[model samples]
Structures are given as structure tokens and as C-alpha cells.
Target: MADNAKWYVIHTYSGYENAVKAAIEKSVVNRNMSDMVLKMEIPMETVTEVTESGVMKEVERKVFPGYVLIKMILTDDTWHLIRNIRGVTGFVGEANKAIPLTEEEVAALGVEKHEIVVLYNVGDTVKITDGPLASFMGTVEEIDADKNKVRVVVSMFGRETPVELELDQVEVVQP
Candidate 1:
């Protein structure tokens, strides 16, 4: 295993996110590939939903269905192990070739970057970069600095719904 590990996307069967993630983790541990396989993640977000009792509940939902992200040092052996994992369809690169993601690309995709930035504070206006609110301008209602997230209000379906957005997915707008 090399010191430089790159991120890559793995396509899995839909609704098998947890299964694939578990399988990858088990494989890494069982095969003693901890150094090569660093992190396995199924990016998810919490959504507030109204229950039948009219109480709002927070539910965690996958941001990208049928997809999992992994950080690993790519090698023939490492690739073989990950590719053979159950529930994984294939890597998201050229056929039979696993292209690891660059640091910049990973950061842009909302994955943790090596270099961290101070997130925008409350009351700051910012432009949404990705997601359904992309290109929409909104003021930060609150900042969860520790989590690198912010609450922004965007008009949806004629109502202002507050959405929690990752810091990297927003660019501060100066008035």
C-alpha cells in the first residue's frame, strides 16, 4: 500500500448502499488491506419529514443512490479486491480501469479535502454551488461550523424551506 491514496466512486446495486459499504469494510479488514483501503462512505443527508401524527422527524437519506465513495491506494491487488466485493457493479472510470479521483475533484464533490477552510458564518449571503439549489442565492440563517455546514433558506414550491448545505457547496456572496 502506498502513502498516496485517491478517492474513487463505486457503483452498486440500488438500495444496497449499506450492504456494499459493510462488505467493503469487511473485505478490507479480513484481507488486511487497511492501509490500502482507508475510508468507505455512503454520503447521506437528513431530511425532515412530517409523520402521520403531524410530528416532524429527521430521516437520513442517501444523497446518491446506488453509489459509494472510497479512498484507497490503487494497485493491481487492491483493485482486484475492491472490484470483487459483493454488490459492487464496477468502478466509475474506463472499462476495467479504475481512475482514482484527484484531491481537487474530491473536494469539489463535497468529500473531505486535505486543506480545510473556515466556513461561512451566519448572516452571510452565499451562492449555492451544487444540488437542486444550485445557482440560487441565499443568506445563511445559521452555521454549524463544527460540521462544516450551514442552514440556507431557498424558495421551493412557494415556501421558504431551510436546507442544510455543505460549506464547499457554497460561495460567499459579498453585498
Candidate 2:
């Protein structure tokens, strides 16, 4: 609800991940608790796997086996509801307490994607604002929004050096 909801990790029995997720989703819809149980996710990744027949195939694999990520407002009712679910062993935390993930952890897990807008384009002069190369001025050479990567050519030791940086790490240098 609003900003109160936080993402929590639920541990489950191995091989029952999908079943537990489905059951919780069904319960949420039936109980009309959509407002409290905001979202559920089983983070996945696609990998190229070689089959026994020597054919390369792309397969979707769970990033975290036996674990499900849930974004919800933690309360007694919601906690009991989820804890009682068939396959859920418990929430990941200390002393049986459910600890919500921090913003950095959530971002690192790829549960949510933060949209970043870039004001500088290739050939634009910008100043690095973060990381080891902070405060260095450079010319943007390439921008990859999908990966949030930017390649900049900076003058170091009086020689041009190319460095890869995050999109948010640089700001456009004004005329």
C-alpha cells in the first residue's frame, strides 16, 4: 500500500516453488487482498544450454531456486496467510522475523527496473559524477540505455582514454 510495501524473500521446499507461488496468487485473488499482496515474482534468467543432441537451446531458469520474492505490506494477517501456504517454509530473516529487502538489494535482484533518463548524447561533453573517475570531464562516445552503460572518452595523462560508466554517473556539460 503506497510506499509501505516492501519486498521479502520466502523460502520454500525445493521443486515446490511454482506450486507455492500459484497457491499464494490464487489466495490473494480469492481473498481480494490484492491491495496488501502487491506482487509476486520468481526471478528467472535465460541461458543457452546445449542439449544432449548437440543443439543449443535457450532455456529459462530460476535465478533463485526454492525461493520466491513477494512485495507486500507485512502485517499479522498477511504474514499468517503466507506462512500457512502449503510449500512456504518461512521468510528469510533472523529470529523468524521477516526482513524486507533494501532498495539496493531489490535493484540488484532485478525484481524491478528503474528507468533512467539520459540528457547527454554521443559527442556531448559531460562530467562524471560518481565512481573512481568522479569529477572527470569527457566526451560521450556511446550510450546503451538498455544496459545503463555509457562509454566516454576522457583525457588522462594528456592522452585520450575510453572508460565505461553508468548512465547516471555522468551529467551533460552545459555550454
Candidate 3:
């Protein structure tokens, strides 16, 4: 069942995505299908807004409106339950046929679960892989797991500078 579980899109009424998600979850619980229905996710992104007063506010922006993504093992019973749930219009596929997302598509949509391995240590030499400082080698100054970011000290012209970057933007270099 675990191997078969995959993400599928369910079309819902406009502005009713969350409601449909809750209904599906309730049905899963009432029908004792926890093993089949793994998870329901509504993808969101953080949008930072700067006001005229120079204040910044972060807001959650739904990536897909009127659609909810679900991870589940597809079966007749599971499909029927999901299709009949309140606020669910239908699956995002051909008529009456549900298609699961491909592995590459899932990863591109940020729906796949990936295990991140930390390979670099503090004071280690690393090469910047992305952003404005790309291709530059820097020393890891600090690691912050809580924020999933790393601080690195890079040589900028003649000065040593500190830069904060996402964990993916750096690769450890051998001394």
C-alpha cells in the first residue's frame, strides 16, 4: 500500500478546497481507511508584502485554488469515497478515470517527501551553487537547522563577508 500511494488532484468548488479536504478526511476516518488515505495537502507559499510605510507582512498564498492534492493508494473503494465527498467536483483527469501524478511531477510540484542530509560542517570550505554569489567558494560560518539555512563567509573583493543562503545553495568542498 505504501508503495502504491501517490498524489492525485481533486477538483473542488471555487473557494471550497479546504472544505472538500476536510470532508474527505472525515470520510476516511468514518470508513476506517486510514491505511488507504495517507494524506491531504493544500500547497501554499509564503508571500512577503512590503507596505508603503516600509513594513513587511508575510501571507500564505494558496498555490492551487479550487484544487486539493491527496496522497493515497488508489482502489475502487477509495476512489468512490473521494469522488462522492462533499464539495468535490471530480478528479483532475479523463472522464471517470483517476490518474496519479508522476514522480517527477510530484517533485516539481513540491509534494514529494525528500530526506535532506547535512554534509557540510562549520568552518568547512563550500562552493556556492546558486544565487548572486554562485561559483564562489566560502567557509561555513554557522548552520541553523531551525531555519534550514547556512551562514557562510565568502571573500568579496578584498573583504570577508557573511551571507545567508538556503541549504541547497552550497556544496561542501574537500580541504
Could you tell me the C-alpha RMSD of candidate 2 in Å? 2.7
Instruction: Return the number of clashes found in candidate 1.
Output: 0
Q: Write the per-residue lDDT of candidate 2 for residues 1-175, one digit (tens) a residue.
A: 4489999999999889999999999999998888999999999999999999999999999999999999999999889889999999999998779999999999989899999989989999999999999999999999999888999999999999999999999999999
TM-score for each candidate, following the candidate numbering: 0.62, 0.81, 0.65
TM-score of 3: 0.65
Over 39-154, each residue of candidate 3 has an lDDT whose tens digit, in order, gives 99999999999999999999898899999999999999999999898888999999999888999889778776575677999989999999989999999999996567899999
What lDDT, from 0 to 1, does candidate 2 have? Answer: 0.95
Evaluated at residue 36, the lDDT of candidate 3 is 96
Error of 3 at 99 (Å): 1.2
Count of steric clashes across candidates, in order:
0, 0, 0
Better of 2 and 3 by TM-score: 2
Could you give candidate 1's per-residue lDDT for residues 42-68 as a string of tens digits? 888899999999999999999899999
The parts of candidate 3 lying over 4 Å away from their true place are 50-56, 118-175
Better of 1 and 2 by TM-score: 2
Against the true structure, what is every candidate's RMSD? 9.8, 2.7, 7.1
lDDT (C-alpha) at residue 67 in model 3: 90
Question: Which consecutive 10 residues in model 2 have the weakest lDDT in total?
Answer: 1-10
